[model samples]
Target: MKRIICILSMLLCMAAETVMAARAPVSEATEECLGCHSSIHPGIVEEWQNSRHARITPREALGVTGLARKVSARTVPDYLLPTAVGCAECHTLNAKVHADTFEHNGVSIHLAVSPRDCATCHTEEAVRYSGNLMAHARKNLAANPLYQDLQQQILGRPVRREGKLTFEPPAAETRQSGCFYCHGTRLEVVGMETRDTVLGEMEFPRLSGWPNQGVGRVNTDGSLGSCAACHTRHAFSIEMARKPHTCRECHVGPDVPAYKVYASSKHGNIYAAMNRQWDFSAVPWTVGKDFTAPTCATCHISLVVNTDGQVLARRTHEMSGRLAWRIFGLIYAHPHPMNPDTTRIRNKSGQPLPTDFDGTYAAEYLIDAGEQVRRTETMQAICLGCHSASWVRGHWKRFERTIRETRSDIRAATGIMADIWARGFAKGPDSDDSPFNEAIERTWCDAWLFYANTVRFSAAMAGGGDYSVFADGRYQLSRRIQELNDWLELRNQLFPPTPPIALRGLPEKPYRVQ
Candidate 1:
């Protein structure tokens, strides 16, 4: 018994040493941080304090929670009680501890509390976010200048992205960084070397880890990120990552509007009605097998594990997951490799180069379809567990038509804009300016991004059935369209650009609507 006790103590000491050794030597102030934080936050403090963000790994930290912990011989074992992901200690930084708990408000408290604050907790997550086009403020605003143009109608005045108070500005603060809270700094942090809070305005690192939690954080040392945004810290449990609750943080906004989209999907409906059926505790989650219906992870992330399980992988944290295609774009289907055919690519090697487009046709075909058809099929299959196959098919068939029509309206709006330019009102191809003319932007904004997202999201799920239509789907859509028309007429714009007459002269382009 005495020998075992001695050996265990030695093991504990060695574990502590292993953790300490992995970290960079602390500066005097950082030393002060290490001294008190580890004691207060304990294992999680030490564990995540030395995470990839601490060491500078470009990939983001884990969003999933950790497994349960055990206390033996009065000493806590390897696992922990919902804290920051412990990198190598709890296994890689991505593993979820258990199941069903994805709300990460800890990010708001730990880092800056704004949409721009994503970098506060999801710095690495933002890279993929920027690529998503929806998260890119510049790109998204450019896509539909009207979203920004119509702000005054809803917000009553424009606010800065910084969440600052102002009269009528160019853009509202929420539109700027998707928040009305926090300073909306691109980055917020404290330098261990400088040993001080060096952000919008603060004295300490907030909750330590250099006080960085801006969603779009730009970082002080030119290194950019905010790992704490999504995965959070202090009690970063896997259960939190498993639930759809975590995504609501920023997803439920006017811009990158996912909260509305999800609320309308058939999968969302089934899950909401039958959430109890899901067995979130399972690994590599599936829809019917592990639980009952589907969740966000079922259609977006990892391959389907069973039928009702939601095993969102630890390796992915882009919010968009590792998904390739941008489905919500003007056109449907993904571009090139993001969307690929293995057999076609293999056959192409025997033929000519890039000029021989036919040679790699198969490879291109692979790119055109769903990368993981099984997952898509699995999601649809979950609906069968409740409704009949014919019922499901019939609904999608109608849905497909609605999507097509909505897309047509979008094309019509674009056509109107193009005609205005082709004639004499706006800049033509020869000109380099496509600046938002607040007026013209107002027209296009309602035509697509807003109305489009709402109607499309409504069609994607249980259409007029529930209260979805009034909540976010049609209410926002109609308002946007009305705003656009009101702005267009007020600006003396050629509404719809002489529709039927000009339709003949408009240039042709291949478009994929649903």
Candidate 2:
């Protein structure tokens, strides 16, 4: 027994030495960074120490072949290939191009690390993500005037004025904390600020959008998207990125309740119950082997394989690469946009919406039928990893039916809103008043934005429980439509009718006095 115990101890010591040897040497610059940070910010250092970046060099990563390969760059600069990815590796890369670059402890370093720097070793992922809608999230939301109005209605401060609620443009801090929290903020170096640090007074760039990790963050290097949004900072752990909790940070809102719907799903239930037994770090993540259930990454981005090691789906950084429909409708569900920059799209009414108020799509800006079919097949392939063809087909049939039914519901609500606007009961698009500001108009918006969105998510994810019936689903949808009709009736009864306003190129009011 004593001889066996000694042998086991010797083996463990050898294993520890092997692990230490496998870790690529940290560069001299990174060593300097760690000299101070390892003590000053011990937590950050510890997390990074446990990351894959701490263990492997670009040279070793690039040598890996097949679907298991993580690094997509074919060749890395000689200077970078020899070192483990560390503070200096990422923060010092392309320093000349970064406007926020500043001398930090005698070394040039940028506060915000952009995708452009990461593209040094992840060329394919960076290029692919550049085409994802998430990469253009800030521009898609902020640049579009129509969306700006909607944002104002949702985030603006409300005050009662002249017996009605009027909204003030939200403060910059308000926007930073609200919608921009997920959509990302445009970061810029406003000026320099001096701070007392462990090493005494140090001058650092004061970034306007500091501390943001939103998916579409505009970095100081003019790069779109923040890889840290998923991979996380310091550690950049693949295990954390593969977990649904990372996605839950941004997708838990009522407007886009992907996480909420997923939490209620059978897949989510299985994940919640058995996730501890799963292998989140496995490359070519095998369905039913690595994970018995899907996380957000599993269905959207992860490279998946079958039990027999056959490739099921290729890894993707373009989150919407397999999506046929953009279920998060502005007014109604429509096909996915052709370009990631949805700001370039305009409807017939000259609105920067994929679909007009009446449900006509901006066809030229959206993906064509063939593209949609291809994307649908791609998504269906992922489904087939766990489900039979008949089951997958049936699920899609229900989802398609839900989209059609919800569109009809929204059309009904929009027609009611148009009637209210025509009768001059509320301000509208033609009258220079925000269409989303009024109480009734907000209710109309809820029909599509909240309730319809929840229903679609529930159907699409096959998590058809209260989410599809009660929790911001069909019940709320039916009640919201009824409430809009009631609101218009109440408004008519409360006030004297004036002559209808000029049609403003809209159709005649759909109702008249008896």
Which model scores highest in TM-score?
A: 2
**Model 2 clash pairs?**
none
In order of appearance, the predictions have TM-scores of: 0.51, 0.94
Question: TM-score of predicted model 1?
Answer: 0.51
Superposed Cα RMSD, model 2: 4.0
> Per-residue alpha-carbon lDDT of model 2 for 1-514, expressed as tens digits?
9999999999999998987787789999999999999999999998898789999999889899988899998899999998899999999999999999999888999989999999999999999999999999988888887777788877889988889777778988888898788889999999999999979999999999777888888988899999999999888878999998999999985888899989999989999999999999999899998999899998899999999998888999999999999999788999999999998988887777898878889999999999999999998898899999999999999999999999999988888888888778787775666778788888988899999999999999987677889988999999999999998889878864655445343432221111
Number of the top-ranking candidate, with lDDT as the measure: 2
lDDT of 2: 0.88
lDDT of 1: 0.42
Q: Which stretches of candidate 1 lie over 4 Å from their true place?
A: 1-35, 38-228, 264-279, 286-290, 302-304, 307-325, 330-366, 369-375, 378-388, 422-431, 463-514
Per-residue alpha-carbon lDDT of candidate 1 for residues 1-514, written as tens digits (9 for 90 to 100):
9999999999999999987565543334344444555665677665556454344222212323332111111222223322322322222122232111122212112223332333333344444544432233232232232233334334445455686433354343344443322112343332312232322322234222223354444333233333344456644434455567766675564443565566666566776887776666455555456656555554443334433333333323343343332334322222233311111222232321111111123244333456444333544554565668898788667666766665555555555555555544554221333223335644565545455655555555554544335654555555555554454455445444454343222322221111
